[model samples]
Target: MLSLKKIAIPMLTLLLVVSAIGLTNAAPSTQAIETLNIGFMQAPSSTGDFGVRLAIDQINREGGIVGPDGALYRLQVVYPNRPPFAPDGVPDAVTSLVAQKAIAIIGPVDNRLAFPNLEVLAQAEVPVLTLATTDALTELDPSDNIMRIRAADRFYNEGLATVLIDERAITSFALIQTDVDSTEALLGFEGILVNRSLTPTVKIQEIDNSNLQADAERILQGAPAAVVMWGPPEDAETLLLRLRENGFTGLFVYRDAQEAVRSGAIPISLARGMMGATSWSYTTPTELGRAFLVDYVTSFNSIPTGVEAAAYDAVWILRRQIEQTGGDITKLREGLLQTPTIYAVQGRLEPSTYGGGDFSRAVTVYTMGDLGGPQLVARFANNVRLGDDDLVATDVRVVGLAGTLTYTPSPSPTPTLTPIPSATPSEVTLTVPQESVNLRAGPGTEYEIVGQLQLGDTATVIGSNADFTWLVINHEGQTVWVAADIVDVFDPGNLLSQLPIVQPGTNNPGIEPGQLSEGIDLTIEGVVLSPPQISPGQPFTVQVTVRNLGVNAAGSFSVSAILQPGNLTITAGSTGLGAGQSAIVTLNGTVDGTGSYTSSITVDATNAVLESNENNNVFPLTYVSDRPILSRIDFVQIPVGTAFDFAGGTADMIWTGTQIEGQNNARFGIVYAGAFEAVDYNAIDPSVVINFILPGSNIGTGSLIGFITAEGRRGVMRVDSLVGTALTVSYRVYSN
Candidate 1:
């Protein structure tokens, strides 16, 4: 039942007409209007609100909905007094919405909040649109009133497995579950692997309770080709950073990567190339999805997250049902169940009969792009369960409404190259590995075909065209160029750098006489410090490897090591170096203090050598001495009683960083320092005794606290936020 009100403007106009007709006592006619109250139970700052609000505004602007009673109805969004994170928030919020006679409600997005209050919601007899991915929600809500907007955990897991295993051909996988909340999700992911008759190379559960450093080491020891991490955003960020720090350069697929990157818990630089699955992405391949992205960004002045897209779709879903059922609360649920598949911004959404209403079964697999956010890799839909033999690969190329997105593959690990000292300069050669390759007169195909080199044929690489895309080689003493991609160039000592840049033309195919006569090019090959990490006031020797990468031999030149912040310069004289020859020159320097400094090693610091490329002479070296190099972690959420290790960059039970109310005489307690920016790491006096205590009311957002770690390393942490049981902080720690 809903309340109806008379139209004031129509009643007022009728009264005026009656008075003009000399019938003042006649009853004035009126039209009734119905009010449809929809409750939005979420934090105002949540991104979900953006979509909900946008949908409501658009509906109201487009002349509202017409009810079954033949009366016009307007949608009104009601908010609860407390957000979902507040104490007794879910139950209280549901009670408030029910009392307010809200026919339907949106959110309590978190599974933890929604699952416990399922009974309260069911008893209220209100249709709810939930964003929770837990499959347990369907079982708990037997009434079928709660419809999930986002895809279930099983669908997301299956889609992720399909993308990684089937599409990418990832054989070795390591699975890590950091949050207990993601236990079912992790199982679903593992189930896919198990169903495929495969097991994860390594599985780590409850990583939050264990040492992350040791776990990272264990993962590295296993050496899986890719790591699939399932956890809360904060935990994912911590684990990801640890993995990268431990030099695990393999592919990383994190479930919470989107939220972590959006929240700035991890920088985009760190998140780049990471893969994840979502119900939707801004880079959705559908035209409807692309239009939604443009409209959302235009309205909000920012890109919408997956939660926002789901929430927006939820509002529209509710509106569609209400329009069909004409505001009848009893008919709305049936109408939703009978509703046809909706082409929504997320994907085609289908109503579930098995108590899992609006089960879209659509998931997108994306890899984070360089600057454009998530790039689409593959999309799974229509409850496509991928099997070993019957795999459906739907890799999509996403073209946004604004522009086309080029999906760049994840970067491979850089190969380490070791230069072997040779008595004679190493010769650079080009070999045709496959079919016969044409030897062009010039660098490009535009030139005439001079000759053809057969497969397995080798040639000496004498020079290259300007861009190095074509190599000029001496095949049987005949000068010709070959496409760089068609032939493999072997230059172990990088002797190709010494080769002359040949000018290619239609008239002249061979190298000109004056082109190869350029003077010696001196370059700093490598710089090796005596100790990688030095102590304060310690003398260190810098071994500078100077190489003559030119056609001619280089005369005597001085190599210098200039250490910054100390302005200490040490120079060593080199006898000389022949073409493609390298000489090690030693220069000694010392730093008087503990800090980070840059060492600039210049092979020809005084311009003593006339080289082909003067820019290649200097090589910059950055190293830290005795001082703790500060590592920054931003907006990382830690629950109460949890300990965070700033040095190790992980949050666990171990009391290394400050805990909310840690034990051990509050060894991990934090003392309120001044403003975050005011507390300088280098200026913090070790002598100033800090009284560490449990965080109080004064230690809310924007408050800075200084603490000494268990290892006696000092650190300063700024409280980014304190919401209920969760405390988010950004911190910088130094090595003692």
Candidate 2:
């Protein structure tokens, strides 16, 4: 979905520059090319390595740069291990680089790790092109020795606000952050909303290992439209997983922490649909950008991250400065300060000397992709270019005065003057490339493959995804879509805008059961029996009703009566039935012992009949099989609130105390009204009440406790002790 504004350069020309750079030679130097020391920490593992290396390799292949003394110079990169979070590791590493006469440094990508090393580099007066996002990092040196190629924290905040408000139109969201710098980043984003005169409620919280789940719950309670997070990669990823587990389905705005989310810390399913902002993305549009992607992947077997892309541009920027100043360090510094803009792979590169200056191509908003990697959704260009009124509130510090160092407006960079192609309304068409392309039911690969567009096949555009990465085409009146990359658009004018911007799967969310139209309709109407109650070992006759409501005749289906204790017998069944027909089937069953038996009558016992409503094809009959009558027993003496070792001593049920019992206590008893029957006991709901009375204690009026007897039968006892001299407890029990 991301649309980049770029110069209309030929793709072939761009490719040649990217791939054939090494073959071209710069003016030859008189002296042996001088080597400039540049340092990198965690070399191969660092995100900035590939870009830096790729750029340097290309420059060296082009005969490097000529120095002021007519000698050519090439960059010599030194790697020192600076394990993350080591207190003195980064400073020591930078010191070592300085001792090696390193002119400038490319990175320490992490803000926390990069922060502590700033003072050391500043004191050494060595300008660093860091990838860290902390806004305060730039303010560390008054002379501006640090030229940040990545967007500062505040710019990322602005980018988030831009996406939430300008693009998504979301009014309310939750804000979560971790680590120390998150506070400043969160505040900056809040300022953007306030400036727009919109005060939508925001639920703000801090999260860490201990409160990750709890804080996620708190955020979910707000029912936010989305959640914005700022933190270290790990912390950010942890919170994202927690939110998903708690069913927090809303937009997720991750800031400058893609490294963590993309690190496979979260399951791919849960990670899908997550959105984030970054300074650079591997899915760049330019041909040069494509070259970097292919070269990096082939070389490293991994995706190049935003940090690496910024470092890549940093090398080129430094290389250009070196060429202009002929390797004079002081002159190079001046050139870096004075240059308005330098075009590179990330588009126009702009750095500022002002406080908290912004970088031009800083923030791109992207969503987690289904097939692989990120799907760029939108881009929020840096609005705070130098001499652009310094938009957004920033603290101004005048470093000098009249006849001294005075504050003055820095000159604006020369804007690239290539004419942007204009779109004219015309018929839109797409041509498949040299290979067969899959046409899917939706825009993403997650959608089902509906058809294929062969090489050179052309289709008229009906719609497209918002990102412009996919095109919806009509193939023989069937709606299908294809990826926009492998196809060329042949719009007469600009017809892409006329198509509807539809999201994948939006039109086909789901189908309901009632929507199904192709299946037989069958139902168990009712069950009738002659003499529903009988003594133990007695037999009963049952009649069942079944109906076929489908359009076609129902297939041969068997109906069977299954007794609860585990006996099954085929009863009256139908070989076939025409639409709107009903049949009565008969079943016979005998109970082995006295108890309540459930006669379950099911049509299509083997599931041979595909019914429209399978759930309604079964019916149940509760038949009572009472036991032989038994004599009642009278209660002699039992203590109230005392345990009763009943049920053959296998279990205990009693009013142990007057204290209310918790629902979880298995021994708690309840009373129910009615004379208990062995066949009807299972029908009674256990009401935990008094089961026994204390000696000489009067039984409370209207008291009853329904319980199971020691013989595994249900029983009910009623005491008439409220008026009698002795306790009188009568019981009626039944076998289950």
Q: What TM-score does prediction 1 earn?
A: 0.48
Model 2: per-residue Cα lDDT over 1-736, one tens digit each = 0111112223323221221122134323223335586666543334576677666655543345544344456665555432233435677777766666677877777676667777765555466777777777777666666667787777767766776787679877787777565777787777787898865355454644567777787887888888887766666678788877788788877754456556755555766777877776887564445655665666457788888777777787777666557555677766677655444555455555333433444567778776446777665556432222322212221110011111111122111111111122234667664458998755678766768888657776756777889887657545567899777665423336534454332222122234323457766644545443444566766655565656667878888877754464646667887664556666777655445556567788888888776776777666555553233333312222223333233323333223212111222234543433332444334544323332223235445545554344455555533332222244444434
Stretches > 4 Å off in candidate 2: 1-30, 42-44, 81-84, 198-202, 205-207, 256-258, 352-361, 384-736
Query: All predictions: root-mean-square deviation over Cα?
Result: 25.7, 33.7
Measured on C-alpha atoms, candidate 2 has an lDDT of: 0.56
Model 1, stretches more than 4 Å misplaced? Answer: 1-30, 207-210, 352-355, 385-736
What TM-score, over all chains together, does every model reach? 0.48, 0.48
For candidate 1, lDDT tens digit of each residue in 260-306?
Answer: 78878778988999998888888765654666676677656777877
What TM-score does prediction 2 earn? 0.48
Model 1: worst 10 consecutive residues (lDDT sum):
1-10
